[model samples]
Target: MSFDLHGRTQRLELSDQNLRAFEAVVLESTPEGIVLSKSAFYPGGGGQPADHGVLLWQGVETRIVGVRKGDDLHLIPAEGDPIPPVGTVVEAAVADERRSALMRTHSGLHVLCGVVFRDYGSLVTGGNMEPFSARMDFNLPEVPPGFKEAVEDACNAEITADRRIDVRVLPRSEAFAIPDIIRTATNLVPDDVEDVRVVDIVGLDTQADGGTHVASTKQIGRIKVAKIESKGRGFRRLRITISD
Candidate 1:
């Protein structure tokens, strides 16, 4: 499912790429964690990992070890941590360095997917990433000779194009209308979902994605194809890493 923020409880789900910190009210608190009225933490989905950060209240710093419900629930592991009462206001911040790196890495994978599909007519079957590296699997009988070199050149060309990256939340009906939306695991979105979040590398690629991304291709800097592995029977996995 696209990580579109649910507006049900008035707690704004923070932007996956842009927001670094937020102020929120504690709607509820328990040993499990605290629910914020709003949050900037990315809950980790769509090939990206959950955000790491801290919540500050009354001079105590509580590390946010994990998150749930798309970042609505900021889970703080109990190590004698102070639990603020309901309605308490707190300052929430995500680790900026980590968030930024993840943003670039996530967008890089999208670029890889876009380039491969555009050039080879392949489709992404699955993918995963760390802060600065990722791997994407595609349905292909076998990678051609010099395929790695070809991909690296094409991807770099697009990156040099400095295309702008756009993110939008659209009505599910409108989102489904786009041809590219169906290319990337569109079925994974639930039928009950009324809205979808889209990430677009303008004129290059677009998909229903729910992760952080850089503002433009230029911000992604250099990318290297680290390795390729055969997953057997018409499947190949390409690994990539962001470099200097």
Candidate 2:
């Protein structure tokens, strides 16, 4: 994929997500959508959903219904809307309520992963999320008795601990030197990715992650292990929900 310098979208949200809205000049305009010089909209990946918000230009505003990452980050407008022209300056805002819920829930899942690994010595095999709901799979022979209750209790305990969550970008060499503290497969990272983004639950867990997260475990509110399912041999899936 190739794009001119003007078509590049600088991702502001990656540095500070609290910056919900910002002004950026339009870099590209097509029938599909527009790309901004910089963006706060998350072109969702890593099991997290994309962000939806609004784009404001002049006195006209249109809802951003979807986002996709390609040669440039494209902010898709609602159907029948006019694409902002190149060189137009616009304001972009993410859906705060939805973003917050997703952030908290994502952090909560990490807490669950940490708790399960600490207690059962199981690594996370897979996970996915939606706003306040999430599920994680582990390489376990079976769902142990009282496992749901124990995970719920343990996750809440960590939330009470209010562990700080930190995000850091490290050189691949430096990251690989950390002795692989992640509870999931690290081989999924491409060898060419020289810089790895790491999300650390301070004292609990750390992994190469690209999703958004809350500042602390306490912000995750309460987590409930809603269900646990046995998925074939050596697999167990746990579903959870978040509430205040």
Candidate 3:
């Protein structure tokens, strides 16, 4: 399998975050899922959700409600939606409103992750996101005074700085060589994986990530630290939202 292939499908979204529409041939088709030769729909991971869109073929429209990852990337069609037959060349359009919001939200989380680690020296324990909101867990036993306001200020400062956000894939050995590639409390990357996709917030932060992000920190808009909670010993949760 080539580096660009996830199963039998060529994952176009990996190289092009701004891609929203593409044409592809159905290699396999069913109500459950459809496999295409090439697709730009992000089959989400790493705290991001899969993209939703529609497939157009022969004047019929089948809505893609979700994506299922397997040997091949499976575009999960809406229940009872018409499934394109194998070999059908369909025009696919990713739901821009959803994907764009997600791109901003995901990048916002990375900015938050970078700021927290840089200022507090806490490692991320876990994280998740939706269209414009997210929460991240950090391993910090003590809640510093004014921690919430401080993080929000720092995050927006970086966003205002308009730092570049770059994504690249490198061989496994080269990626881990960076000191902060794995900012998580524990390494989450699989040992069998031979390559690593890195998401770098210029000089602020770097991590081995496999999710879509904006072109720069400004594209993330303003990140609002909505709330903070103590889940357990050394576990602190920060809830955040993204706004224009």
Candidate 4:
């Protein structure tokens, strides 16, 4: 399975983060999920949640609540919604506001990851995000003087710099050669996966990722380090909120 194709569906979101709507043929359909001939719906992964949207067909609207990933990408519909019949041509749209917010949040997390690693030399243990808020856990035995305030300041500064965020697909050998990919908290791409999609915050950080992101750091808006909590044994969880 290449990075842009999931089972039989051509995954459109990877190539165009800005695409909100597209027409697709229904390859398979059930009350639980619908598989499309092509889709721009981002199947959630890498700490970012899946997208929510709707499929319009024959005057019927099927609300997609989440995506179920497998051999094929299955779009989960809102319970009680009508399922499109197989072969039905439908107009699908990804909720723009929610997706746009997520793009900023995801990029903000990358900026946070890049900054923390550069300044503190800490490794991320885990992280998760919602529209404009996120929490990233790092392994830091000791919080240095003014770490929280310092981090927030640096993050905003990077935003001011307006660094470019670039995404590209590379072969596994070439991608793993980049040192930063090894430092990421999660490098779980399977051995069988030949093509790796890399997200780069120019001059900042790079990771093998498969999630949608904003085009640049400044697009992330402002990142406020809200709280820092100790999760015991050298683990620190930092909560953040994104704002315009």
**161-238 per-residue lDDT for model 1 (tens digits):** 999999888999999999868555336787887888888999999988777889999999888999999998998999
Backbone collision tally, model 1: 1
Order of the predicted models by lDDT, top scorer first? 4, 3, 2, 1
Model 3 residue 221 lDDT? 88
| Per-residue lDDT over 195-220 for candidate 3, one digit per residue giving the tens place of the 0 to 100 score | 88899999899999888889999998
* Residue clash pairs of candidate 1: 11-37
Best by lDDT: 4
Cα lDDT of model 4 by residue, 87-118, tens digit: 99999999999999999999999999999999
TM-score winner, 1 or 3: 3
Which residue runs does candidate 1 get wrong by more than 4 Å?
A: 1-4, 7-16, 70-74, 78-80
TM-score of 1: 0.91
lDDT of 2 by residue, 1-244 (tens): 1111224777777778676889889988786878888888878877788899998888888789888777777888898877787899998788899999999999999999989888888888888899899999999886677878988999999999999999888887887777555577446677777777788998898888877889999999999999998878998899999999
Please, what is the TM-score per model?
0.91, 0.94, 0.98, 0.98
Pairs with backbone N, CA or C atoms under 3 Å apart (clashes), candidate 4: none
> How many steric overlaps are in each model, in order?
1, 0, 0, 0
Worst 10-residue lDDT window for candidate 2 reads: 1-10
Candidate 1: worst-modelled 10 consecutive residues by lDDT: 5-14
